[model samples]
Target: MKKIENLRTDYKRDQLNESSLASCPIEQFKLWFNEVLDVIIEPTAMVLSTYSQNKGVSSRVVLLKELQQDGFIFYTNYNSLKSEQIKLNPCVSLLFFWPDFQRQIRINGLVQKISHESSVNYFKKRPRKSQISAWASSQSSVIKDRFVLEALFHDFEKKFKNKTISKPPYWGGYKVVPNSIEFWQGRESRMHDRFLYTKHQNNKWIINRLSP
Candidate 1:
C-alpha cells in the first residue's frame, strides 16, 4: 500500500474573517450554498448525524430538500434507524463539505417532523418510480437479497399503475432547527479559520472566532 502520510494538499483557495462574514449565520450559509451550487457536484448532499440510546451515534448522507428560515429539511422513511434514533434523542448534527472550495459548515440542532401537509406536497412532486420505490423499500431493515427488493418494487409498480401514488405514512420530512452553526475555511499550510454562531437568550445570536 502507498504511504498514507504522503497524501496531503495545502489549502489556499480563500480566507474567512469576521468582517467578511454575515451577521446572521443563515445569511452566510445562503451565500456559501449559492457558491457551492456552481462548483460542487451534488451540492445538496449532507451528512446527518444522530444519536441512539442503544446504538450511540450514527451518520449517513442525506440530500437536503429545502432550506427554511428556521432550519433545514430532508425526507426519509420514518421507520428507519435514523428516525428511531431521532425519536429517542431529537438532537442531531448536519455537515456540509465542499472540499474543492476548502470549506465546510457544521450545524448542531434539534430535529422535528415536518407537517404532514408539507410532506404530502413534496411527495406529490416525486417521480412515479421514486414514489413506488418509497413504498417498496423498508429502509434500514435486513433483507434476504436484492431480488426481494426488486420484487417488492415490481409489486408496488403494478398496484399503483395508472393511478396517483400517495405518500407513504411511514415516509416524511424532518426539519433541523439549529442551535449553533460553525463555518470552517481552510488556509495555507496548517492554519485554518473557524467561526461559530451560538443562539443566545432573547432570540439573538452570538458569533465568536475559534482556533483551528
Candidate 2:
C-alpha cells in the first residue's frame, strides 16, 4: 500500500456556526442540500447504516427519495438485507457527505415503512424499466448467474408489455425519523466545526456545539 496515511486534503471551503444554523435541523439540512445541488453530482445520495443482532452492521449508499419535516425517506426492496436489518432493529443512521463543499450531515434515527399507498404512488413515477426490475430482481439474494437475472428481466419485460406495471409487494419506502442530527464542516489543519441537534421529550430541539 502506498502510504495511505500521507494522503489528505485540508478543507476550508466554508464555515458553520450557531447563528448561521436554522432552528430546525431539517431546515438546515434543506439549506445545505440546496446549496450543493450544482456542486455535487448526486446531492441526495446518502449512506444508510443498519444493524441486526445476528448480522452486525451494514452500510450502503442509497438515493434519498423525499424529505419530511420529521424525517428522511428512501425506497428499497422490503426483503433486502438492509430492510431485514431495519426490521430487526428500527434504529439506524444516515450520513450525507458532500466533499466538494467540505460538509457532512449525520443523522441517527428510527426507521419505519411508509404506507403502501405512498409507495405505490412513488412506484408509478419510476421509469418503466426500473419498475419492471423491481419486480424481476429479488434484491440482496444470491442468483445462479448473470443469465438467470437477464432471463428474469426479459420475462418481466414481456409480462408487463403495453400494460401498467404494478408495484411489487416486496418493494417499498422507509422513513427515518431522526432523534439527533449533526452537521460537520471541515476546516484547515484537521480542525473542524460541528453542531448537534437533539430532540427533547417536549418535542423541541436542543442544539449544542461539539469539539472537533
Candidate 3:
C-alpha cells in the first residue's frame, strides 16, 4: 500500500451560525434536514448506537424515516439486538453524516415504542414480501442455511395469501426522543461550525455554540 503525504479537500462552502439555528432542537433539526434533503443522496441513512445490559454496545447503519416532537422514529424487530439494547437501556444516540454537504447531526435521547395502531398502519403499508418476511423470519436468530430462510419465506407467503397481514407482535417502531441535538458543518482548516440545542428539565430547548 502506498501512502500519500498530503491529501486535502477544502470545505469553504458554508457555515452554521447561532442566529440561524433555532432555540429548540426540533426546529433546528427540521431546518438542517431541509437543507441536506436535496443535495445529499440517501440523506436518511444514519448510524444508530445503543448499549445493552447484556450485550454491551453495538452500532449499525439504518434508514431513519420519521421525525416527531416525541423523537426520531425507525422500525425493526423488537427481538433484534439493537431493539433489545433499547429495552435494557433507553439512552440512545443517532449520527448522520453527509460528506458531500460537509455536515453531520448528532442526537442523544431515550427510546420508546410507538402506539400499536401506528405500528399496524406502517406494517400494512409495507410491500407484500416484507410483510411476509416480517412474519416469517425470526430477526437476529441464527439459521443453518439459505434453504431454511427460503422455506420459512415461502411458508408465510402461502399463509398470508389473500389475507390481511398484521404487524408482528415482536416487530414495530421505536422512537428516540432527543434531549440534545448537535449539528456540525465542516469549515476551512478545521475551524468548523458546531451548534447544539439542549432540552432542559422544564422542557424548554436552549441553543448554545460549541467550540469546534
Give candidates' CA RMSD values in order: 0.8, 0.9, 1.7
Per residue, candidate 1 scores C-alpha lDDT tens digits across 1-212 of 87999999999999998999998888899989998897879999999999977999999999999999889999999999999999999999999999999999999999999999999999999988999999999999999999999999999999998999999999999999999999999999879999999999776889999999
Error of 3 at 133 (Å): 1.5
Q: Is candidate 1 or candidate 3 better by TM-score?
A: 1
What lDDT is reached at residue 37 by model 3? 89
Candidate rank order under TM-score: 1, 2, 3
| lDDT tens readout by residue for model 3, 23-112 | 677877788788888888988898999997688889998788688876888999999889878878999999999898888899999889
* lDDT at 76, model 1: 100
Candidate 3 residue-wise lDDT at 162 = 92
The window of 10 residues in a row where model 2 has the poorest summed lDDT is 1-10
Which residue pairs show backbone clashes in model 1?
none
- Regions more than 4 Å wrong, model 2: none
Q: What is the TM-score of each candidate against the true structure?
A: 0.98, 0.98, 0.93
After superposition of all CA atoms, the RMSD between model 1 and the true structure is 0.8
Question: In candidate 1, where is summed lDDT lowest over 10 consecutive residues?
Answer: 198-207
